[model samples]
Target: MPDNFNFEAAPFDTLSEYERNLLRSALSVGYYVPGETLIEPGSTTLALYIVLKGVVEERGKDDQLFAHYGPDDLFDVRGLFAGQTRHAYRAVEESIVYELNAKMFHELCERNAPFASYFQASLAAKRQLARRDGQNLAEFILTRIAREHLLPAVEVSADLSLGEAARTQLEVGADALLVRLEGGFEGLGIVTRTDLMAAHFQRRLSDDTPVGTLAHQPLAVVELGDFLFDAMILMTRQRIERVVVRQGSQPVGLLHLTQVLSLFSTHSHVLALRIARAETLDELQRAAETLDTLIATLEGNGIRLRFIMQLVSALNEQLLARVFEQSVPAAFRSRCCLVVMGSEGRGEQLLKTDQDNALIHADDISSEDALTWMAHFNEALKGFGYPQCPGGVMASNALWCKSVSEWRHELQTAAQEGRPEQLLRLSILMDAYPVAGNEHWFSSIQAQLSTWSDQGERWLSDMALAALQFDTPLTLFGGLKTSGERLDIKRGGLFPIVHGARILALRKGLMVRGTLARLQVLGKHGVLDQHMADNLAETFELFVQLRLSQQLAGDRSGLRQGLDVSRLSRAERDLLRFSLHVVKKFKQTLGRQFHLDTR
Candidate 1:
């Protein structure tokens, strides 16, 4: 075996070390020049070929190029197992390959079930494995957390005096102490430096008072296996410095926010804290400027796309809510609801895009006042880095910013008319989430929309069919089909999964806002089989992650909505193509489920 061989390559990487060593010993290197044929149609299979360098092209029966394989790519596994070639494999460039003869290949397969499964698995199975493999990548934050040395929890008796608790905290050199509950309470409580300082300044209790009185119950807790990102969310949401770590309900240690911050330290927590503390638009803008830097840092650290989206969504909402509050008077704030539509509302947005927002004013508020406030709110958002929507789907537009009764009437009218464009608009509105003001107003409108959507099959079918607007970009031979230089991955892949999930959720009366959450709900309620739901969820995540990577790299250009496949590694391209195959299957399912052809 070569010293520089990359064992991390797919298919080969999936093999156990023993299997790899056995295969490696039997491998023989072969070379092919550009335009040289390695395998021809109807030719008997001789060996399993793994590309060590350069590219190979696979052509269909008509001699049309269908797929390209590069370094560390494997081919002819299916043919070698079946004893014949289905497609011609020709070198696209000068190439070096390692060959394992038929006898050795068969022996390896017979000895290793997992290695055999890697070559025999279906496209959906490959996608699942790819997703699982991504989770195991070295840069993932969870992988790092698993290797960390956690600190033990510093515990103190609830009956101890404040002075005694302080002395114990100093003695242990801990920032916070857990108070063991007795008598009335059954679980433990927590007391931090903030609590101690507040108590001492308020003069509300003497130092002789029991420390238990200072400790707060119902503490935030995380399991030992929880991802660091999840732990960060818990701390951010609860506004706490530390959380109790448990291993199956038994207290194990304390996870301090400062320790987490030191690990990554890209200033995300500081930015989030600043957003919470901002009192003016300028202050919010200062925090908003850090968003791009924060996003780049998180992506670089290999944080899961879903977690990154959630964090950015949370921060975006905070920025918008603060601007809304500062612009709209307190009196008017309660009378109206500020809602975000589309990706922002779904908590799946990764970067700042055009604003897709609306306002739902109370019935008592006059149209003039509502519009006046909303126009200011829109301009504020634009100034804060959110561009105005091209289609005018924003609060500044009087049509979108309306009273609850007005919205109710508008939806009813749209449903009755059943126009495709109106239905599309309504479909976008279906994803609305309240970011500020009276959420009850938005919920009231959502309930009415849900009732209408549940009763109308025609409407649901129309919405689901929109997902088929773009083809899945895969050829019949399961190879990618690209236009000139680019592929619109969002339209070709992401939209189908998202819209299909949305339609299913509506049919089942599932009110979940995000695509993955809706799929889980549908699966839980038996609307979709577990396997199908899991495949869709994993595929959707891959699409999001790929698109986000392109966006982060500033690769967005005219007519290019996804990554350029020619630039990706052999492994990445393989994963992407397999994911698209899953999308194709999902779209077919949606077509049958909705009777799209007849419609």
Candidate 2:
């Protein structure tokens, strides 16, 4: 290796002899002159690069500049990732880069599990950013704003030539570059590998061709104050590969399309797709068994608990749809919607949880035969491993399976009157998320939801009153509250966040379906700040993982000791304890925001 040649780009500090030899053999090392274009804007190169020296710049083109990156930051990863190039890159100074050809990178990762694991996550993050807009917009209006969503900006003014830009992208292994424009922050534009290719094809163009000529303007930006859904929308509508994430003018992060979607992929995608393809109920069960294996894999890999819930939510929705498809009549299926309650509704489900579901059917055309078919549908889902809804929320329960008019009346009556039965009815039903069929039915009911938002201050008061139904298990001494021997992470940590997010969202006319989603939207309205909402979202996620690990371990070890609060590893216990405080603080925030009567 040449002097000053080092591999800070590698994720780990020390490498085994075999790995070092692999890197040495497979790697092509080179030094870039200052102002040499490392990668042309718009040219998609299927290679990963490691920077050994000097600064590299990543700028967004066409109004959605991503975060600027430097030494130790991997770039052009998407080239290594499924071989798609999205951004433009350049080096700010003379730089040295290790060009790990795509084929070599794949081989190295495949041979080394530790390296492969990190590589998988890195690639997954990119893919997620590519596919985030698939979510229903209306349903996401209430999600939490996350710190990760911040657009990253570096404060520097180094104008490198197009040649240098290309070289830098290759050096940092980045897919794109976002250059700082002289005017406003959003005035920043980006250049991609595609642009570089365009430059390459134009033989008249010189390495000295001012990259700024090709720099697209108006980097797409969402404020730190913007809701997460807004970020989702910007990504979805723009159709570009990444977003210029920002907090005011300063870039704090890059919201890569691939990274966002990776959050919901993994096991859930596997289960959902497999279950969809299965033809028989028995086949569905076999596919679902794959979930157990998936869970074990997830636990072994050590992903956070909150992310697991996202996987579970995606999987549950997928599994439910498959079950409904196999059992429900095609014509009637579109006329009905599946509603999940309890933990599933609150986005806190962990492990394989019990079912809390209800169905809503169109009122005008139901016959006894229709009822029979719906009943069979419910039973089919149960057999496929989603236990039937407790408390009769299942479609088989006549009280719960009502027509559109009936459902509206029930919610309106519950809100207007404030009786024990009505409160219980609304409480059980409010968190409903429609999974399959004529979402129009759910949308119709959603229109009515606003009816209470403006006029029903009393109803808001009542819901806030009922919100206290779920409690944080914080004890008198200010430590975590215990339920018998094991701490009830769900009630103590998760529920408070869910309920607070829910009540705040509902009171604000935010009709989002998930807790984090709700907090996200509310944050945009100044109802909750970004950090406040994200902390609560994190709290809910941590509790879920703790409880889920306990549940999964219980089934495997037969040690129903529950989660040993004290026995937890230091990291796990610390995260849980911190999350506990997050939930506690969030509950108080909700009460203050809603102005609920303490009495």
TM-score per model over all chains: 0.81, 0.55
Per-residue CA lDDT of model 1 for 1-599, tens digit only, reads: 54455667655666787877887788888899999999998899989888889989999878977677777677887789789989999998999988888888888778866566667875445543444433433243663244254666777888899988878878877678889885432378989877887887876678888988888889788888877777777776655678778777576778888888776566667877898899888888888888988877777666667778877887787778888898789988888899998889898877777889999998999888888888888887788777788899998888788999989987887768778877877888878999999898998998887777644666778788888889888866566677764677888998988888887877776788799899888888887878788878878888787777777787432124656777666666777787888788788888898898786
Question: Candidate 2 lDDT (Cα, whole model)?
Answer: 0.63
Judging by lDDT against the true structure, name the best candidate: 1
What's the TM for model 2? 0.55
Error of 1 at 328 (Å): 2.0
* Candidate 1 Cα outliers beyond 4 Å, as residue runs: 1-45, 50-73, 80-99, 103-140, 143-191, 202-219, 244-254, 413-417, 475-477, 555-560
TM-score of 1: 0.81
Residues 1-599 of candidate 2: C-alpha lDDT, one tens digit per residue: 43333533234323566776776776777688766667766676756876667766665577344543444446676656656656566677888787777887787777766566555543223222222232443223335556654334433233667888888777765566777657677567787768877887865578877677777777777665565545544553444556666665576656665665554333344455566678888888888777767666665455544454555566667677777787678878887876777777765565555667777778875746446766887777667666665566666777767788888888777666777777666655657777777788888877776555665556665666555566666554344456565776655665567766766766676777777677778777888877777666655555555566666766642225345675564335435555666676776776675676465
Question: Candidate 1 — worst ten consecutive residues by lDDT sum?
Answer: 131-140
Error of 2 at 53 (Å): 48
